[model samples]
Target: MTNKPKPVIGITSGDLNGIGIELIIKAFSDQRLLDFCTPVIFASNKVVNFYRKTVTESSFSFYHTREFDKINPKQVTIFNCWDEEVNITPGVLNETGGRYAVASLQAAIEAFKEKKIDGLVTAPLHKSNVQSESFSYTGHTPFLKDSFGAPDVVMMLCADNMRVALVTEHISVSAIAQHITAEAILSKLNIINSSLQKDFGISKPRIAVLGLNPHAGDEGLVGNEEQTIIAPAIKQAKNNGILAFGPYSADAFFARGQYEKFDAVLAMYHDQGLIPFKSLAVGEGVNFTAGLELVRTSPDHGVAFDIAGKDRADAGSFIQSIFFCADVINQRSEYADQRSNPMRKIAPDVVSRLADEKIEE
Candidate 1:
């Protein structure tokens, strides 16, 4: 029997001015990463070399090529998206950084379209800098949702066994409550439940839904959204055969380490979930876009402009993102394979006859 081919993971060089390149170079320096998946960085050799100079300690080199067929599985390959000369500026955000960042991402998307990559691991990108008439989505999740025609997607932050999914992300605080209808919560619940099973391989995922108000509305004294909106959503989720529970008070639940008991937690908003996760996960957290056809993951931290060129940025999260992408890709493939030819159900009469034969014997 032959061994299965490794997954081709596409890595986008996000924001040349940021620490994304540093993290990428640092993560691949170990070389053992190439054994799990073939890494294809969607950036030019010149751009990668610019940051490679800062991380002089790492002896990471890449196979520079513009063609897809030239990608080396055993080595890192830089898929040059552009050939023109561009100025490099660390710790500064500019239009050029955003422009090239978009170029790298679009190139990776094209590779996905051609079925060249199995999964994608993106570096951090400044949301404001990348905004234009063509790309107007808040972050990668929305852009990918539109690109793939996904009806809905969940921005899931994962670290170790702890997973937190948000119902609303990158929106104003005032607008969060208005968006927290039962339908929206139930939709997120379904997506989170499905992802836990298919992406993470949880057989029966138990989802803990957090409340929208303090003390879960304290029996509707502080706010009624928990009782009126969130509770109803959890009920509807259970009706749909989802093991969903609670409009639990977010603060107390996390303080008491209640999340450890459940498979996943569904936060009402972005910060409500991320604050605790970032605090707990620190440098090892990974942001996974759940409910997408393609597997995409990113480091939980953003572009650290302060430490961009100082070589102080840790590659733990970025490396974790790579491993997470491979795990999800394999999990999805295995899950699909198991479902492809399911065992036929035994007929009632056949079962009864077998039972009677056993009894007679």
Candidate 2:
């Protein structure tokens, strides 16, 4: 019998000046993480070392590699981009750090394309500091989408069991009204539905779509967007057998524990979804990019410039992101393996029957 290969998770260190390196070091230091997947950090050795010394006490050694063949699971592996030289200060942002950050992300994307890694988890990066004019695409979601030729992508933030997906991300509040359309909402719903089923192992996913206006337009008294745009999209998605329903008022819905009823909630804009989500799961939230050929997730928070070098950055979100990536990869592998073996189908039924029999006793 051949042993299955362990899933390799590629992690990109975001901005050198921020807490990206610190969180990366703290996350990898947890020996418990190695039980699930092999983690490979796509970064430079000097940057990692500098953060370790400045932020926390270092115990583990990082094996620096220029090629995939040099990766070793027993040691924390660092894939050196060798992109450029930068004197990485703990709390100051620099163009050199930005350039290296972009290079690290590009290297990870190439590794994913080459089938060297199963999924990718990224740290936060500064948009203002990166060197290339062409890299002006907000955050990692758009960058990854354009890199892989995926025209449509959705950003979902997961906090424990509850999940919220954004229909429009990284756009201004003024532009959101123009961007909200039936096609756009339907596309995001499809991506969320498919992702919950395939990646999350949810057999039948239930999605809730939030309204564009307060009180869901109060029957068109407050705003007509819920009637003219959102309701039509929800109806369309349901007609296509997506199990989608909503146009629910954003304020009252979350306050009433309505989010627990669905597997994922689709918000019309960025802050409309994220504000409540972060309030509920601030330190533990993990941001996941859906609708990509490859899986990508990140810590939901940004660079804490105030306490960047103070050793006060919490690694909870970063740790959760790694575990979430591992869980998704495992589910995908398990589903594929079951499809290859017909006998595995009966295992669930057999277990169910045994449980029923025991209940009668």
Candidate 3:
């Protein structure tokens, strides 16, 4: 039904010991998925074979590509990120896992820079182990932000039922207040609104902005952030032609089920949005990096070291992540074309003339 060219999705295998490879293997086992998009995994052949022999139940075909021109569209292919000798441990956390994780990601990023790949889907990596001189940020979002020199970015957690973005992520709770300035809030809103329009193909997005304190700050009794910073930013965003709303109290907002009415929700901090999001849609949620020039997504869950080799880690989120990336790529392509030649608005007289012409025909 779709005539669009298949996007080559670049997947970065996360911590070698984690369930990242297992998730990738399980998701790609079905050949029919190839009809949707081409997958080019950035990993070593030995590491993949180890996973196939150890964890997976069925065979997954992969072509080892010496060059991007050799990548096959019908079959999954390994991009040959590194040729270094390595050992595969299922459940242990070590420095080696981080090293390859970085290697795979850097190779994919280079390809993305060169326009060899359409988008990226990253597997889970442990926060502590994935550190390097090149990647010192907390997680995937900041690293991508800095790598591309993006001024700022939004970490949006999206599922079938809900879409929530954070104003702040991976920052200390005590320091959250200091960062909740009007500028930060407004910038995030701009990102969320723009992403909802271009990335997700939403025409007019209605966003809900949640409060930082309890009980909507009880009219400044609980916290002054709602009055001093959050509200002013919402006003500024609305003035800028964004359909943004709220300073909504998180408790009543979710408990009363008010989120169902909006296109997206913006939270003040990490736990404020993620706690409820995970509870409602953990296995289905996809972590999307909004406001970046390049498209990237990941499974909402982290490196589950406990279930590394147990074959218990669910591939649902990762599968969704791939499909989401594909959809975004298609939408972004259309968005670019539309932006270049935007639709001309029809006036009342033009509409009447068109109706008259149709009647005459």
Candidate 4:
């Protein structure tokens, strides 16, 4: 059989002080990874070697390049972002590592903007230290939203089986109720629905939305948000021909496996969805930024400061992210093909009427 075209996946080496480089090196060590797609690391070769030497005795190497033209799809390529030598330390938080993380990320994003890479797989970044004068933002999600000029995007966490999205992310718990209006919920629901179809290749996806309050507001006894805001949003979603449901009690939804029935779930706040998703995902999930024109996924976990140089980081999620990006890109291509040359999927009633007319004729 002939080989299929592979997407060039650009990788941003996040926060050099952490396990970002370790995971990036370990994940790409396996030669079989190149069979799926090419990976280009956006970091200095010196930093990558520092992590490799600090953590391992192995001799894994990446071809260094000055520009995108030098990329080879069969092996690893390090797109040198930093010119001069920089301090490379493990498990130490400083401005140097933080600057490098954002530098690498920004370079990879520019590569993405130029269409040099198909998808991006970013390693973990320290939220506190990664802040720079030019890169001051809550996190990657908002920065990416502004970078791409997208009006809105969803912070979705995806695993093999479970997918959960947040309505309000990186915010205070007290601020959640204020943001959980009918409009916000409906907007998230719509984004989820669209991403499911276009990004995830789900046809008429079923989404379950979680409520803001305990027991989903207890029908106004516990709170009024669910009864007034959430339910109305669900109503609007259904009316818009979206397979949306819920105002489901967040506590009971996952307790009884109610999430298994749907393609995706929308939670009211950060912890409401993430706590359960993390507990259930068991360190195997991938944080995907849904509703963007490009595909981006990162290791679900964060910068493991304590275990930075231990060579103990698990590259499972990172590897899965690479494969998932490939799958999502393929799914998107197939979805576009189907849309452009849609299949004969007429409504059942319309088909019956046509059949009856033919018989009568």
How far out, in Å, is residue 4 in model 3? Answer: 2.2
lDDT of 3 by residue, 1-361 (tens): 2477899999999999899998988999878779989999999888888888765476587998769999889899999888877887888999988888888888989999999999999999888988777789798899999889999999999999899999999999999999999999999999999999999878899999999999879999988889988998999999999999989999889888899999999999999999999888958999999999889999999889898977888889999999999999999988887787565223545888999999999
Order of the predicted models by TM-score, top scorer first: 2, 1, 3, 4
TM-scores for every candidate against the unseen true structure: 0.94, 0.95, 0.94, 0.93
Q: How does residue 24 of candidate 2 score in lDDT?
A: 85
In model 2, the runs with Cα more than 4 Å from the true position are 1-3, 338-343, 355-361
Q: Pairing residues by index, what is the TM-score of model 1?
A: 0.94
Cα RMSD to the true fold for all candidates? 4.9, 1.9, 3.4, 4.9
lDDT string for model 1 (1-361, tens) is: 2466889999999998999999999999999998899999999999999889899689798899989998889999999999999998999999988888889999998899899999999998999899998889788999999989999999999998599999999999989999999999999999999999999888899999999998999999999998888998899899999999998999999999999999999999999999999998877999999988899999998989889988999999999999999999988887886677443223545778999999999
Clashing pairs in 1: none
Per-residue lDDT of candidate 4, residues 139-239 (tens digit): 88998999999878899999977999999999887777888888878888888999999988787899998888888888788899888888888999899
After superposition, candidate 4 runs with Cα above 4 Å error: 1-4, 57-59, 343-361
Q: Ten residues in a row with the worst lDDT in model 1?
A: 341-350
**On a 0 to 1 TM-score scale, where does candidate 3 land against the true structure?**
0.94
Superior by lDDT: candidate 3 or candidate 4: 3
- The candidate that achieves the highest TM-score relative to the unseen native structure: 2
lDDT of 2 at 108: 96
Residue 279, candidate 2: alpha-carbon lDDT: 90
User: What C-alpha lDDT values do all the predictions have?
Assistant: 0.92, 0.87, 0.90, 0.87
